[model samples]
Target: MSETYWDRHGIYGVMAEFEDPEQLVEAAKRTYAAGYRQMDAYSPMPIDGLAEAIGFTRNWVSLVVLIGGLTGCIGGFGLLYWIAEIAYPHNVGGRPFNSWPMWIPITFECTVLLAALSAVIGMLAMNKLPMPYHPVFNVPSFAERASVDRFFLCIEASDPKFDLEHTKAFLKELNPEEVAEVEK
Candidate 1:
């Protein structure tokens, strides 16, 4: 194939191929301890402790969804309450205008709808999705085996401690199958 990216512009990082997820997790732990901040791991399956090993354990998507749901619930009820009790009072069947029971269904629906929507939208926003392209894709043959039976760890050059030769040596020290450069 054509030389992808790092060849033309600059190096993206170093990628190491491992036989299994355990090895990848160990390597990630070592890299993290070595002060490599910008790194990621890919495995055929969800590898437990991998995220923790890489030092990423915080997320706020749930909080965002909760806030969205509450806002939707209150807005839904308030809007109808304003319309029925304040804006234009419609006395139907001599029923009370401040009929909280009548507004339950719409408020519940709004809460569910906003919660679901916020979960999806907040997750996407938090994760910065829709990125159809990433430098890690240029790691040779990563596309084929990464989702099959292999695990890969990439230490990005953007990490402060990253020096191409040093990073390559570091990955090799992890006893991976092979350590290679990732093109941008």
Candidate 2:
């Protein structure tokens, strides 16, 4: 039998609780500087530069959305062209078969529809949604305070620099109110 990830680590990581968002941001920056890559922070509200401090530089969501929009635009225009000129060419009211003016509205509508749908699907896929469970939620206080008025920084055990005792000590040095182990 093989040891599972949960069994191997026996914990998710060490979490430090902070009362202020400033503390959370500073702690995250120090953790990142200490070479801890697999870490996350939570707060009641958005904190400017917090993500940058944690080394979150790039987001592929915009690229995904752009590709989706371009695809939609090209596909919509192509479909309209095929339908109007080849598939069902109708000589209605002496209008030309390749009348592009009338196809503009439907083509624009199709473009918007596909672009919107792709954006939604892309976002869901990128974020790995439908996650009904997470180890961070295992903490009793985290469940309630996470969305209210507290900030938290969790250093995952999976990080290369993570040593149970050493990481705990490191988090403690950050002067947090409390440091607790996160269970899997």
Candidate 3:
């Protein structure tokens, strides 16, 4: 038998589609109330209050940025200090050994460089980028409407409260145009 890649770590759950963005928001709220956690929502455009409805909390992007910036500042200062004090210290024109003003430019540049690099890397890591494959792509009819005029909500099988029959019935209650099973 051919090995099924998703057999072990697949999202086998029910999906709900909604016409009005408000309905989707309400549905998400109800889904959360019903103890569902591993679920996601899709819409043609941004929806107000939808994140709050689904109990979505802010990610750690800001924290990551702050830490990166601080680290960069410290690293830059440390590098410049080491270079000026120890490595080939040149007392040009009898200036002090620890020339604070002269080192500012390089320190500033290094700080900016490291902070920018960290922000980029942190964003990619937080969002789980470079994901080449996802099970949502397997939904044949789903692709057409996702980017167009429809909204979708999916509850994953891995959720603690996920039950095949119960989840399907709950989705049907949301009055989606169609409810379908998604694998992986």
Candidate 4:
């Protein structure tokens, strides 16, 4: 590809390396204050308040799970009702036409099963999981540093305020060891 193509679409973001969690958090705060959205931070371990500093508050996985559970519950109950009352209409030893008690176990199981699956699938989908490749992986410095006792903050090129030179200068001002441009 030509340099223009690389410049236009292949650059993912600019990343900076910090040695401490506090430094990373401060950098994220500064970057947020500088009006840069679409940023992310990675560290060897979770840092307290990092998500808040990065302006992440809402999560929707629980809502997905709730919807799944409700669907499962209603479907399970409806299936049992159709089987006993309408599909077969069996008179199993003078029992009630619709044995609500018998449906309890199956309904509970379905609810749990669907809720668990929803939690896992919704979380993975929301987080963009199963990601075998990413532009961040193209940054050689990130591969060695991000996972081994170093914290990295990346301000993505997709951010409205992202300018190659300006963002680079801003990251440099945060006193990172290196401010690297990540290729897609």
> Cα RMSD to native, each candidate?
4.4, 2.6, 4.1, 3.2
The 10-residue segment of model 2 with minimum total lDDT is: 1-10
Q: How close is every model to the real structure, measured as TM-score?
A: 0.89, 0.90, 0.82, 0.88
lDDT of each: 0.87, 0.86, 0.80, 0.89
Question: In model 1, which regions exceed 4 Å deviation?
Answer: 1-9
- The digit string of per-residue lDDT tens for model 3 on 1-184 reads 3333334656566788788798899899999998898888888899998877777898677777777777877888888888878887878899887888877787778768877787889989877998998777667657778778888889877776777788899899988888888877
Error of 4 at 51 (Å): 2.0
User: Compared with the true structure, what per-residue lDDT tens digits does model 4 show for residues 105-157?
Assistant: 99999899888999999999999999998889787878987888989999988
After superposition, the stretches of candidate 4 with alpha carbons farther than 4 Å from their true spots are: 1-9
Candidate with maximal TM-score: 2
Q: Give the Å shift of residue 9 in candidate 3.
A: 10
| Candidate scoring better on lDDT of 1 and 4 | 4
| Most lDDT-accurate candidate | 4
Question: Which structure is stronger by lDDT: 2 or 3?
Answer: 2
TM-score: model 3 vs. ground truth: 0.82
Candidate 3 wrong stretches, greater than 4 Å: 1-11, 44-48
> Per-residue lDDT tens digits of candidate 2, residues 5-44?
5348679888999999999999999999999998899998
Q: List the residue pairs that clash in candidate 4.
A: none
lDDT of 2 at 62: 73
Q: Can you rank all candidates by lDDT, best first?
A: 4, 1, 2, 3
Per-residue lDDT of model 1, residues 1-184, tens digit only: 3454334558888999999788898899999999999889988888889989999989798899999999889989998899999999998999999899999999999998899999999999888897899887777579778889989999877776778888899899999998888877
- Backbone clash count, each prediction separately: 1, 0, 1, 0
